[model samples]
Target: MPHLTSPAPTTAERIRSACARAGGALLAVEGDDPVAVPVHHLLSDGSFAVAVPLDRVSTASHGMAGSQALLELTDYAPLPVREPVRSLVWVRGVLHSIPPSELTETLDAIATENPNPALLQVETPRSTPTNDDETRYTLLRLDIASVVVTDSTGAEPVPAADLLAARPDPFCDVEATLLWHLTTAHNDIVARLVSRLPASLRRGQVHPLGLDRYGLRFRVEGNDGDHDVRLPFHKPVDDMIALRQAIRVLMGCPFLNGLRARR
Candidate 1:
């Protein structure tokens, strides 16, 4: 197979993009025994902001502020296949409660970018913790110390500032549906993409793996094992219209050439 230089998203951008797709993570905090709680969250200002159920973790553990905490987010492939896991993001950080003064403002800024319904369920800092608190949750933050993103390529540490600066992939949200439609309704189109691969890789059964602004991915189920490969578009495309044109160009679709002629 030809050794292709991967033109993938920067580690920072990939981390942030994965976080955007993640709905929940395993929140591990220090205790008599390390406590790992499954919780939904919001990422804001370099922290994993979560609504911790009152019944789950003790509120007095606040003394452990700045203590070690771990947050794990898993990214799955857009389409179902033999190996569905796409990437793993592990964040090492310190866990603590968000003070009342900052709760409203922090959520406000987060809402502007991510108006996740989970944020609406969070109680205001002034609200009293009630006996029925099991149904409710408290706001807390995991201040990041270091982050590591592991994917098909390999594992590497991503800087905190770099992750904060990067934006999620423009096509991340629609990628799954796009791949699903192609695989279920247009398998031949996706299979046509495999011809771009080297002769050696074409031996296996080809399946649509993923889609992003940069290009397409194919998972080949070979007799030995599954092989993942990428075929980059002529360039990055940020929207559906541009993406349609890019794919057509990559596949040498004459339809796109007709459109370009008019321009």
Candidate 2:
């Protein structure tokens, strides 16, 4: 089935849209580079270039015939503008070349929005097998797909018509979904903190007092009497501090970093 790739939007606009849509966007590109890296390379003819690295050459050729590949560009870069690095606006679309005249606006937008724009130089693909020079390549004009915009400000509760137009969806459903996931994640912390309690202290008298500013509070009844205990979970979710310490531990889990704050 043919996938629909949306038009390009401003980076600021895309981040705002992405934030509004959610924290970040997931792009499906058949390539060898990281999703955030640019696949565009400048040519002498003033056109964008798409490079098919050696590893992905076969895949690119199989899918897109005649030295061209479809790409879904996303702005997943973490801009270190705030304490917690702010997420950038990401756009996704089928990157295909149009007549130079038609791409005037799109070209201008890419130049302004890209944070660290790099070029991809596609080498020509050779059919003949050679022992000396095994590698071959092909370069094509760069193009983009949908632009998912978002930011810290997000969409106001009462948004203006123009402001609403800038968003990918009708409203800020992405942020709403993220908040929902975060809220439900509180239960996970409650379970973990309860498990951490000593079995002797957890026996007969441990009664949960519910969560508060201090964290999970419980009254433990021992042979003597009842004693109040609080488990302050500063980083129940993705603790940046602990994350650094246990980066290796979380390397396998892609969603671990985002869910840490909820824990």
Candidate 3:
């Protein structure tokens, strides 16, 4: 992929998009004996709401509000690649337990945004009720303090304000579906697109890696190793029609062959 020398402002938006698709995150509590747990999460308005089984709730925190914690979210390529991890976002925040009174409202909001079968378990009754807290569930909220995004561009801290204000790319959610279609259903198109790469890279097996409003990313498998490259659109696209048009233009470019030789 094109090396981004400095972290872009879009980093925050990309992090948010990743969180939406991740389904869950790795929560790490800071202390002498740190605890880490995988918990289902929802990110909204710069805060992360996580659903933890009653058993792991105390491990996540000391049952204290305003505790310090870190939430790590990763973005991976939809397809197989040498380096599947595209990026990582670490969120530093203060953790707080949600009151039982608000659990219903909190879970409803999470379901409305990203529905998952696991959330349904919360509504089901447990047959055996032991005083063991593990029989129940708890919702924990992490109030944002800072967000650090690490990718090919390198790691940098994004201001809480900037992270809250940013919005994910218009095509963030559907890019994976579209890329999957292009790779599985459209080999001829992919070949034509790969013909645009530099002559040295054309010998490699190319596959779609990712897509964003700015461009398309591909993974090239060669004898030495796998490499990533970005093919930028002539202009950024916002809607499906425009994205299609831009792709068509890229594939139809007669000068791509010539450009390959020059590269």
Backbone clashes (count) for model 3: 1
RMSD of 3: 6.4
Query: Each model's TM-score?
Result: 0.86, 0.28, 0.77
Clashes of 1: 0
The digit string of per-residue lDDT tens for model 3 on 118-139 reads 5654522332454543435556
Clashes per prediction? 0, 33, 1
Off by over 4 Å in 2: 1-27, 30-38, 41-52, 65-84, 97-121, 124-145, 155-263
Regions of candidate 1 where Cα sits further than 4 Å from its true position: 1-6, 32-44, 59-64, 126-134, 257-263
lDDT of 1: 0.75
Better of 1 and 2 by lDDT: 1
Tens digits of lDDT, candidate 2, 17-99? 44432322232354433332234422233333443344454555344323223333333212111122233433333444344
Model 1 lDDT per residue over 25-135, tens place: 676676634433334344646777766655555564544456687888888888778888889999888878788898898778778877776665567856655555345
What ranges in model 3 sit over 4 Å off?
1-9, 31-45, 58-61, 122-136, 200-205, 221-226, 253-263
Sort by lDDT, best first: 1, 3, 2
Residue pairs with colliding backbones in model 3 are 1-228
